[model samples]
Target: MGTTLHPLNPSDANLIQARLSELGYYRYQPEGIWGLVSRSALQDFKAANGLSADDVWDGSVEASLRQARPTPASDTPFGEWSVVGFACSAEMNPRKMVVSAKGIVVGSMICDMQGPLARSSADWSGSVLCHIDGRDIASKISLRVSGQRLVDRSVIGTSTIVPTSFDRCS
Candidate 1:
């Protein structure tokens, strides 16, 4: 018997669809299905990227997708910032954080991480697993600092959750 090929999962399919859409390869809603529309889009992407037109979600396709969507970097968030105040129900003091990029330090500020820093897509929204004081914590932090406005949500210490927005300090 020969090995069988399985269809992409809904989540993976959605991711591919979204990336394709962003790259102008797909023009349909991301319904998380590897149907004809998705296959055609994938083929187009492969042809455009000079890859084999297999119309399959292979390693090469995934790599191309990743290359198209890079993570947001610290340099993208560099600049003097005005804190918009944080809202939390628990007691916790603000701590300092340093943003850096490509081994160069960018900026530092007094802010609560509430969790460890993580890099998501250029869109800057996702969930990350953090470990604090030997304890594992899962938090959802949305950071969109590439633009003039920066927004963040995180949990500090044990129970303090803070949502903060910052604007460029002129």
Candidate 2:
């Protein structure tokens, strides 16, 4: 079987919203709703990228969006983050993650779903997937890296993990 995408799902919408927000298209929080705002942003993005401004999130549109992500500066999520949080079945806690531009030096094992940061945004956000037993599990992980803080949210299976926020450690 192939991967199926449900555009209406909040998790899926969150991913789309994060990508759009990173690309300078969407301006509001990624609340995961297919409203006029989201449609307008998608249309604007399509028009700018030489695609028909239909506001439809299909395979073609997704492919285009994936290609439009900004490259990361380095292959790691390092430097001092102002805020950081982690959530799992057993425990949820606020923690400090120490990583570098090269890769993860300390803290939870995390990396960008995309390789590097080719583009930057004011309120940039991205998605991360959890790998268990060498398989990509069906979990929703989102990260928002802003001026001095980073917010991480992980939803596993059908359980919602409360979002964890972190600030860049000075």
Candidate 3:
């Protein structure tokens, strides 16, 4: 049988983003999506490497990136979190995480990550208090994640004694 090749999946976004960010080109947190920032970073990489500024990522782009180095600011440690990493289940903006919980965690488990965007954890004894993206969480006390639209009725940064169901991905 011949060797099989696979297409880029959602999980692959962070890996590529990590590499690019390490190279000092990608300037945003590696969420599992190829957005404008990622494209811009790729373009910058191409330009700096004397490659044509086109959308198509051929063999040469991959080759150049593989030979590149990473930056020091890729990540900082998540103190006392001796658990598996996680990703935001939100389809659009997937936040990276290093979380410990009382029960099951939805979404893919990412490795060596800690999101300053949000902190989801079980704050009390047998109580799962989930924290999602901190981008707008500070202003909003709760969320209404409905029908995969968004994780709903999520209360963060408060002593809201609740269960894991309140969290979309925990």
Per-residue C-alpha lDDT of model 3 across residues 37-132, encoded as one tens digit per residue: 676566545544546544446676676666634212212111111112334443533342222211212234222112112323211112233334
**Candidate 3 residue spans exceeding 4 A from truth:** 1-8, 68-170
Between the candidate structures 2 and 3, which one is better when assessed by TM-score?
2
Q: Per-residue lDDT tens digits of candidate 2, residues 46-118?
A: 6445466466777777877788353321211334443434322223222555432222212444443332222
Better of 1 and 2 by lDDT: 2
Report clashes for each candidate as comma-separated counts. 1, 19, 10
Predicted structure with the largest lDDT when compared to the true one: 2
lDDT of 2: 0.52
| Cα lDDT computed for each candidate against the true fold | 0.49, 0.52, 0.39
- By lDDT: ranked, best first: 2, 1, 3
Structure candidate 1, residue pairs in collision: 114-155
Model 1: per-residue Cα lDDT over 83-144, one tens digit each? 55532221331331222211111122123233223345433333344555556565454556
The lowest-lDDT stretch of 10 consecutive residues in candidate 1 is: 100-109
Query: Candidate 1 at residue 97, lDDT?
Result: 26
